[model samples]
Target: MATEGIEAVFIETHNWGKSVKFFQGLGYQLEFETDHNSGQLRNGDGPTLFIAEVPADRETPLQLVLKVADADAFEPGDGVEVVTPFEDTHFGTRLATVRDPDGRLWNLQAPAEDRS
Candidate 1:
């Protein structure tokens, strides 16, 4: 419940290249990129977006990262299902994932030094 506003969102695309290009036309630039699959884009300090290509049949969704005070304390409720428990991330953060009632997944995260 104690989280900052959403910091980023990942929108899985069946055609990752096209999505990236489309956003590029709108002035978004690559923030972090990987040739393997996914990349993040940013427009100033506003929320960044990550795009990735995945099989169309894959049921898993892209994530929406909500900055939280403590990812470990975020319990599942209000029609939400905890899919992954909080774990230390390589990017200096604590993270967990959950699915909302509408089937949208959200990634609960906290900065490394905030509260792991």
Candidate 2:
């Protein structure tokens, strides 16, 4: 499979409301929002998100999204928990997440950056 480019970064926030405001203060705009499990933001480039209501009970740290050439090359080890698998999204990309050895979460994505 061919790899794409960096798409976006998703930050799992315990409170999307405050996180959104914080990011907006940092010059990130609230591009879109939903009543459900997610929201989207932009910082003059692409979406750098602050998702709300991600349960604080999470066993991992903040979700850091990294744009990769191919998501298939990424595989989790024993310490890395695969919370989600790579799959097509409405946003036009394949995305996945895993907890690294240090309990840090990462969002590995395969998709081109949005120029819109």
Candidate 3:
């Protein structure tokens, strides 16, 4: 099936506090923050923004997260490169990585299957 749309934007920054304030200044509200300098923010009906802090020595690129109803139902048609298969995430979702024609990477996220 086709991807639903962008679900969220994943951002990694060296300065977590500054990044959070930057987005807040742009009208995004902090939804929930983790103890480890990570959090989710939202602005009206727009996609959520998930921010994480990384070490200054680490280089992390911004990522756009796509939504899929079910990971098992996703199809990567010809010309679509699947860099990794969907796997369970600690935050409670199944995520996969794919590369576009221009070599930029995007993340695909699906609701986690029921564990019960």
Candidate 4:
């Protein structure tokens, strides 16, 4: 596995305020928040947490973010299926999705390539 381990956990919640509070209660510090009720939190040297607000009717599952050196150069080995190709995210990172053998989807994150 070329992955650099977990970078962050992507969490979707209908109650953004509650969710943010819950994580904060766990000792996570708010790093920065967006105007759209989404924010990132960090707890020491552990992986960061990204909380995003979603519609109540939306059924988004929690996703683990795997860090990679380069999203465009990532390779899904063996039984891993590529769910989504690497793409630019609104948060200024490159993201890709892959499904493991157990049918769980994971997000691969990498620093955005300098297009300059």
Which candidate number would show the highest TM-score if scored against the true structure? 3
Which lDDT value does model 3 have at 94? 99
Show the lowest summed lDDT stretch of 10 residues, model 4: 71-80
Off by over 4 Å in 3: none
Local accuracy of candidate 2 as per-residue lDDT tens digits, 19-97:
8888889998877888875688888876467465678786324555667675657555556578788877776777777
lDDT per residue, candidate 1, 1-116, as tens digits?
A: 65578878878888878888999999999887787678889988887897888898875466678877765565556766778878888767888888877887778887675643
Candidate 3 lDDT, tens digit per residue, 10-39? Answer: 999998899999999999999999999999
- What TM-score would you give candidate 2 relative to the actual structure? 0.58
Model 2 CA deviation exceeding 4 Å by range? 1-6, 56-60, 69-85, 97-105, 112-116
TM-score of each: 0.71, 0.58, 0.93, 0.88
1 versus 2: better lDDT goes to: 1
Identify the superior model by lDDT, candidate 2 or candidate 3. 3
If the candidates were sorted by their TM-score against the true structure, best first, what order would they fall in?
Answer: 3, 4, 1, 2
**After superposition, which runs of candidate 4 have C-alpha atoms over 4 Å from their true positions?**
none
The whole-model C-alpha lDDT of candidate 1 against the native structure comes to 0.79
Clashes of each: 0, 1, 0, 0
Which residue pairs in model 3 clash with each other?
Answer: none
